[model samples]
Target chain A: MVSQLTRNERQLALVILSALALCGLAMAAIGRDDLIGGHGAFILLASLGMGFVVTSGYYHAEPSDERLAHYYDDPSKVGIVLAMIWVVFGLFIGDWVAWLLVYPEMTFDGGWASFGRLRPIHTTAVIFGFGGNALIATSFHVLQRTSRARLPDQLSPWFVLLGYNLFCLLAVTGYSMGLTQSKEYAEPEWYADIWLVIVWVTYFVLYLRTLARRKEPHIYVANWYYMAFILVVAVLHIVNNLAVPVSIAHAKSYSLFSGVQDAMTQWWYGHNAVAFFLTAGFLGMMYYYLPKKAGRPIFSYRMSIISFWGITFMYMWAGSHHLHYTALPQWVQTLGVTFSVMLLVPSWASAGNALLTLNGAWHKVRDDATLRFMMVAAIFYGLSTFEGSFMAIRPVNALSHYTDWTVGHVHAGALGWVALITFGSFYSVVPWLWKRERMYSAKLVELHFWLALAGTIIYVFAMWNSGIIQGLMWRTYNDSGTLAYSFVDSLIAMRPYYIARAIGGLLFLIGAAVGFYNIWMTARGALEESPTNADRPAAVPVAARTIEAGE
Target chain B: MDIDHNIAVVVAKSFGLFYLIALSIGVLVYVYWPSNGKRFDDAAKNVIHDEDAPWH
Candidate 1:
């Protein structure tokens, strides 16, 4: 990867790394009395390690000018590999936590091994660590293809990818060390959030620059979704994380918003973290990759517009749904519920548009496990969105809010919609990226499909059963009007379901491991070489015919 | 800036209702404008490419 850059670019990379190391050193020196010092040491060591690697490759001959004729994909390649690593770590930890729910003794005496710390680690690792990397990687690939332009520069993309991963690294490590703002999904403290903002701004700028250089007359819908995801997330992160740190050295900070306002601000940030980050970003992926894989265009350009804009406009109001029945004003909760319900139109429009786009290629979906991952993903997307809209209603939220049903609802989207689609896109793109004819084993892809599907079903079902039971038990009244069931009774009831959920998670983790192996082997040229021209994006001459969504 | 609760409620609800309705109508009109079929077709076909490279 370093050899692809010119000597000057390498020097620039070295300088950037050195600057980062200096920042790390400053943090370590100033915060030596606090936990931030340990994070500082980690950042310093990571930067130095990367700098040395760059130094080793500095003297290699620069890539030919021909490099300019190709998309800058080195960053995307690295992003995919990093995503796979995080998925495994996240899934393993998730299952470990699930098992701990059943057997409370399944933990070390260490504070980090406690359920509270490990739970956030699992959430952050999978959502931000795995899901974030996939979005960044695929967004780069899709942006180039749809725009028909190379990225404006190489170094910036690398900076965005590496920098974002560093944020993820800091977050996972910091959580274990008891560093947090205690803001649900927005858990990372002030400094790490600041670093993410810097990285994110660079990403947004890079995207816009590439879009400005597009050969197409109109911006693709996928780019629109990506732009929304990038822009709104910045707004959410900045506004919600407005805090005054107790000290630069200390990891503790007081939020700018206090009381009910803090609760409102948090969900506004939290739910949109779901909206823009999870939904919009992956919808963008589906818009591009799903159609391309099926050799179809979008089902309706008209519906794409409706869905894209409708989602952007409506999702902001729905955040208050997360704050339902809380100290938040009644009107705000009502507004959230109304918008949450209204969001179903756009959500289903996108989902239906994707499914309809697959009409001509249903046979291909049937035969191809890669396409099946996406097909199920769209179904899950539709299913989960409907479920989400319903769950946001006041009566429903009364039962589901604190229950495991909420967990089931989230995984329906996270595992079934987000992850399945990511894996699907990866299966298709990995072989293409490596310029291979196909994966190392089609059978393994098929195996992976079943494993992931079965795992998701089991996990979601187990949660649903436990969640509803827990909700019912909590609300049940005896003749005297007191609750019929104790919290411990509910806990005892959840034991079997917890074990099932862990087993399900284990299967999902195993599937990801198989996927990584297949991807690795393909990248290493383990497969017998075949004419990969048919699957190549360069195969079809566009001037001869435009591929419609369906006949 | 210092509107009463009733005024604030009316303002918020009215603006939200009008905004969503206007957006829906505007999008429907633009998408269904009969003359833009070819353009939408072209946009949808953006990924059906001869080369995904920087196009030498």
Candidate 2:
């Protein structure tokens, strides 16, 4: 079925389907003695599901002559194509690292490698590679549409893509070789960090040039958010990653700060990296696609600006919140806590604006999986922000800190907020890019949504409970004030939550696989396949109508 | 002790002065309204009128 599709689309489908098949076979072969292997299988299947959804969306429709004409003149496609390649390659590297971690015995060396190496590899691939590609691709497309201007110096966009992937490669290779500064977020060696800095500066320049040449009168709110993300993230990355390389040959570096100061600085980078890269960037996506998908103006432009500034100023201060009860100065902790509390207002402002933007289109939330994903993501963003601010309070941190609760909070934002929005943007754009009328099956999309949602809920709630319980138990004092529970006892108690969390991951992965299948069949099915060597065009019925509407 | 105390006092005063100046600038910018409703309208009109203007 996948063979009938285009090269990129076909390979993507094959990877996913093969992954799913591997999981199924593994499950049958290894009947549950060790669930670890089974869990790995589930992850592969889910990865495939993601690929399927993306490819199917890409191949659903044919580009019209006008759309093709625009492509003929521009180099943005070169960047886009490169971006796609980097994401695929990144996925493979991430998988290799993760696979090695999951089955350490399978390796030649029975060495126990920490998740520290694999975690960054997997995260950077999915977040920076996949999510970053989606952002750049969609931003290029949307900027063109809103500006009524062709992308500037198409070669530059390609440079951005190539340079970015090169940086990813450098980072991953360096990480595997054990060249790191040991920062949770800024783990990349100095050389890789330098590479990223160069690539990012180019991206910023390209974006600004394009904006300058826009034919539109007012810059869209999306541009504001995107630009802010770019600017603020650049500052954060530079400030936090100030380190000197040990030597050119080895991927070793030392941070400027030491001990607690380093931890504080790292979290400062870490949290704001979340704020700007994940939250701000996705908000930019939401601002554009939500309105475009709903076919309505944003609820209030004023609200957007207010939220934008509020988030920009407020989120920076909230980073210290991660240090809650740490020895990072009481005054600093108070600053973090206070700013975190203040962040809720801006967060809710964005969420409310997005929700209210769908004032009359609420019904579509039932029918349109894309809109539904965005809506749910918005809701989760609010929930995560509230939970984060609350956790920042020293009192609450006393119960939630260093527990699975923190993990739950992170996933609520990462899986629910970031992933959902990314998926929605893909759903909303791939059809336009592919020139398809609509997705092959809305039902599959809906299934994917529910499966992931259920998975997220179970996963988050289980962890939250487990974490708080553990925190409480650890702090609980007997009348004699002996340690309330041994560390081993806490570990035993956490087993149930881990099992539940894994199960949640399984369901989510299964949902993703279903989505993948739907997308694959959509691209490879009879309607998509060309009978003759006609060099068939992409099928975009709705965009055609929109063109007609313009006429 | 006397030298250290003097240095600390000098540093504090300098920091205080810098912050005050920065705050005033922020306040001034907040109050300033360079573009009114009419000016914004005129700018939009100008862009619309120049239909053949090159973009990019």
Candidate 3:
């Protein structure tokens, strides 16, 4: 079977096997005395055992040369699978965390299952593991298609995908083992951070090299957004994670900044993580997938260019908004709030552009569940950005800060915008990748859409009600000028909302499960292929449609 | 020390405010420049143009 693999697949298999062997050796060197080390060794051994099984399975399969010829690289396929696994793992853990909020006693032994430990695991898994892989996979697909160029090299893309997953593995496992620098989203210690930087730099170089060799005369707007995401995220990660390790052998480090500076630095990194990681990268996904699904050109090419610059320039300043009412300088906070408000212009422009791009394609959107996901994602993008700007205002921040309202706002963007757009793109891309004419179940896509939409609505509203009530309760004064509600009272008030939130999460998780099943069935050739629509041209010329119609 | 701190604040504020304004305007100008209109349009259509390419 191994001998039957194409040259590329054989080389890839060799690389995977060698990497596993090296990891096994490293684990043996670490010695299985410590719990973390023991678990690490066990996982590596299991993976090594499974590696052969997967390699053989893949080698024995015979894909058509036509299908193989279409997608020049298979790393995107690998990325999609990894992304789906993380989606289930991350969302399940997130639901578990939500349940823990309602039933604190559920942390029976208070070890790995403790809410504190698992919360970071959930965040890292979803953000870095799920969202990151989706971005990497889609960006590679978009870049190659738009440029009409193959990736500069096959090995670098694989290095990036596997290396990134390895970093995520170390980060998640380290968190469970009670090792961290306690920097919110930047919690992974020095070693994991360094590994990520190496992988990220390679990714940047790979993107640049691919773009340089493009057959097209002009670079697409989607590539610009993706490039900005990669470049800015690299800067943010490096600067925010500057730390001194006590020793090279252990997973511990001290941040370079202290006190007010540290607080400012952390929020700067945190907010930009949302901006670049969540917003910009997914915006790239939106730019490509929305237009592709709609079968139309973007509404305003100029608007995309303007918004791209506006967002990149304004977002860096807006990070200070996260540091409001803190020891950070008053002037800095004011600057933060000001820029955050200004940020609304560009955010709305992009959202409007996407919606308007559906001018002639409204019928398609109505008929297509995938297009509906993209449409709803655009609406939520506008809604969340508006909510974000509102929350950044000082008076509004006073009410919303330290409340579940912030959590609600984040979910509005994350689950509503990021995850929905990702699902839309995945649905569109998977059929083409797997040589299927269509998904196994369009009906399942529709079901998943409703489940996701209902879940988001429930989750957002529950947090809003709980947050506002908690905020109002904490601020209310009694007749004797005493606090009206104790902290526990507020916690008690949030109990129902927590349960609602968990139910919402469970619905989303179930929807994802159905989506995966549909895609898997489609890949296995169990689904009926759609009849080709000969009426529609494979590539529609942009000049054929008047831009005035979009306006 | 006080003077140095004051200078730093002034520079930071001025650079953040003015530089960002200039940059935004520069981007707007570049995007709307008539000569570049064709280029931008080509890019907007790039993805669809390559639909028949080997990799869809």
Ranking by TM-score: 1, 3, 2
lDDT of 3 by residue, B1-56 (tens): 46665786898777766887788789988988999998887777766653544332
Model 3: pairs clashing at backbone N, Cα or C within 3 Å? none
Evaluate candidate 3 and give its CAPRI docking class based on DockQ: acceptable
Worst 10 residues of 3 chain A by lDDT: A62-71
Task: Quote the lDDT for A507 in model 1.
Answer: 92
Ranking by DockQ: 1, 3, 2
- Which candidate leads in DockQ? 1
Task: Please give, for residues A144-250, the per-residue lDDT of candidate 3 as tens digits.
Answer: 88887777655678768887988898889888888779999999887678878998999999999988878776888999999999999999999999999765434
- The lDDT of each candidate is 0.91, 0.68, 0.85
Of candidate 2 chain A, the 10-residue stretch with the lowest lDDT total is A67-76
Poorest 10 consecutive residues by lDDT, candidate 1 chain A: A528-537
Q: What DockQ, between 0 and 1, does each candidate earn?
A: 0.58, 0.14, 0.48
All candidates: TM-score of chain A: 0.95, 0.78, 0.89
Question: Model 2 over residues B3-56: C-alpha lDDT tens digits?
Answer: 664574576458745864575456345424455334333332332221222343
lDDT tens string, model 2, A1-551? 22223455445455645754575455435534432234334435554565565466555543332432252122333334443444445444444543443344545552224456666766676667666766666677666665656655434565466556656655565555555677776777665577578878988998888788777767766887888888887898888889875543334567888878788888888989889988898898898888778877677665676678778877876777778666776766887888789888879989998899888998988778889999999999989988988998989887888887998998899778977886677667655555566656666778889987998898798889888888987998888979889987887887777777767766666665565555445544314434333466866699788999998
Which candidate gets the maximum lDDT versus the true structure? Answer: 1
User: What CAPRI class is candidate 2?
Assistant: incorrect
TM-score (all chains, Cα) for each model: 0.94, 0.74, 0.89
Q: Which stretches of candidate 2 lie over 4 Å from their true place?
A: A1-113, A513-551, B1-56
